[model samples]
Target: MRMIFIGPPGSGKGTQAQLLSQRLGLLHFATGDILRDAVAKDTPEGQRAKPFMTGGQLVPDIIVNDIVNARLRSKNRPVKFIMDGYPRTLAQANSFDAVLKEQGLDLDAVVFLNVGDEEIVRRNGARWTCINPECKATYNTLTRPPLTPGRCDLCQHLLYQREDDDPATIRRRLQYFHEQAAGILDHYARQGRLIEVPGRGDIEAIYASIVKALGK
Candidate 1:
C-alpha cells in the first residue's frame, strides 16, 4: 500500500492522505511535519534546515533528500507508507527513486488530486486559523465554519486568515505548483504509476474515490 499523494496546496491531498493512511494502517510521511520535527529536535539536518525555514525559503533539495534518505535508512523505517508534501520537484523525485531502490522498495502508486485553480483559491480564501499558539485550530468557512464567526471554537480566540491563504498568495502558489508538478506528474505517468482523482467535493467522497482508484 505504499503510495505518494501529489497535488497543489489547498487541494486536500493532505486530508486524503491522512484518511487513507489510517484506513490502510500505513504510516503517513508528511514532509512538512517531518521537517518541523527535525527543526524542533535541532539535529544536524534540522540545524541546516532551520535558516531556510525561518527565512520563508524552500529548503534545498540536498538537505531534504538527506533527511528523507536518513529516515528510509533508519532501523525503524516505515515499510508501507503514504508520502505527502514530498518530492515536490523533479530532482527530489529522482533522489527518492534512488533511495527507494537502495531500500529495495517499490512505489505502488502516485495519486494525483486534481482540482481547479479557481476552486482552490475559493477554498483557501475561506480558511481561517486560531491565533493562539497552543490552539492553532483551522476552519474553512465554506466547509467547516466555526460555531461563532471569527472565533476559535476551542479557545475562543480570534481567528485570522493566514497570509498564505490570501487569494493573491494562493494564485502565486498555484503557479509555482503547476510549474513544478508537470515534471513529477509526467515522470510518474510515464512509469504507469500515476492515478488521477478529483479533489473537489466532500472529504469522505474524495477519500472513497482515492481508495477505489487504488483498488482497495
Candidate 2:
C-alpha cells in the first residue's frame, strides 16, 4: 500500500491522503505536517526550516531531503505509507528514489489529482484558517464551513484567509505547481506507476476513484 498523492494546491490531496491512509491502515506521511511537528519540537531541521516557512518561501530541497531520508532510516520507519506532499519537485523525486532504494522500498503508485485552475482558485478563495497557531483549523466556505462564521469551531479564534489563497497568488502558485508537476508526473508515468484521478467531485467519489485505480 505504499503510494504517493500529488496534486495542485486546493485539490484536496491532503484530505484524500488522510482518508486513504486511514482506510488502508497505512502511515500518512505528510511533509507539511511533519515539518510543523519538527518546528513545534524545535529540532535542528526545524531551526533551518523555520525562517523559510515564516517568510513564505519554499524550504531548500537539501533540507527537505535530509529530513525525509532520516525518517526513512528511523527505527520506527513505516512499512506501509501514503506520501501526501513530499517529492514536490523533480529533484526531490530523484532524491526520494535513492532513499527508497536504500530502504528496500518501492512505491506502488503515484496518484495525481487533476483539478482545473479555475476550480482551484474558487476552492482556495473560500478557505479560511484559525488565527490560533496551536489550532490552525481550516475551513472552506463551500465545502466545510465553520459552525460560526469567521470563527474557528475548535478554538473560536478569528479566521482569516491566507495571503497565498488570494486569486492572483493562487494562479501564480498553480503555475509553479504545473511547471514542477509536469516532470514528476512524467517520471512516474514512464515507470508505469502514475494514476490520474479527477479531483473536482465529492471527496468520497474521488477517493473511490483512486482506490479503483489502485485495484485495492
Candidate 3:
C-alpha cells in the first residue's frame, strides 16, 4: 500500500511511519532525510536546494518536488512506499499527484494524526536528547526520564533539550501546521483517501489504530 503520514511536529508521525514501514515492508520516504541526503550528495536538485537551506529559508516547492519525483522514478525503490513530511502544501500535493500519475502509481491513503496544540506543546517540551554523537539516546522528562537526571543512560553524556523543542517553538510549529495543512487535508478528504488516526495514548496503541484503519 502506498500511503502518506501527516501531522504537526511531536505528533508521533515519524515514529509511526518508521514502525508502519517495517511492519508492512514499505519504503519509508522521509522528506527531511531525503533533502539532507540530496544536499550531501550534491545532486542537481540538491545543489539548487542548498542556497535556500543555507539561508535558513524553506526550499522552494519546485526543488522539493523534483527531488521527490526523482526518488519515485528510481528503479530500485520499493513499489509500495510510505511518505512522511512531503507535500506540506496544497501545491505540493497537486504536484505529487502528477508525479504519481507519470510513474503509474496511486496513493492509497493519507493518514492524518489528530493531535491538539496543548498536547503538542506538552509532548515536545519534555523531550531531551543525548549529546554523544554515536549514542544518541532520547529521554522524555514526563514519560521516559533517564535514570540519572540530565544524563544519558547509555553514554552518560549530558542530555539537553533542543531549542526547537521548547514549548514556544512547538506552539509556533503547530500554528504553522494549522495554516498549511488545511487545504492538503481537504484534497485527500475529497478523494476519499484520508484516514484520521487518534494521536493520543501509547505509541503501540496509536500504531494499532493505524493498522486497523489500513485493514492490515
Which has the greatest lDDT?
1
Worst 10 residues of 2 by lDDT: 31-40
Candidate 3 lDDT score at position 155: 83
What local lDDT does model 2 show for residue 108? Answer: 95
What residue pairs clash in candidate 1, if any at all? none
Cα-lDDT of candidate 1: 0.94
lDDT by candidate, in order shown: 0.94, 0.91, 0.91
Per-prediction CA RMSD (Å):
3.8, 5.0, 3.6
Put down candidate 3 lDDT per residue, 5-84, tens digits, no spaces: 99888898999999999999998999888998999999999999999898989998999999998988888755799999
Which scores higher on TM-score, 2 or 3? 3
Displacement of residue 90 (Cα, Å) in model 1 is: 0.5
In model 3, the runs with Cα more than 4 Å from the true position are 128-141, 144-162
Distance from true position, residue 35, model 3, in Å?
1.2
lDDT of 2 by residue, 12-123 (tens): 8889999999999999999998887888899898888999998989999988998899889999999899998889999999999999999999999999999999999998
**How many pairs collide in each candidate, listed in order?**
0, 0, 0
The full ranking of all candidates by TM-score, starting with the best, is: 3, 1, 2
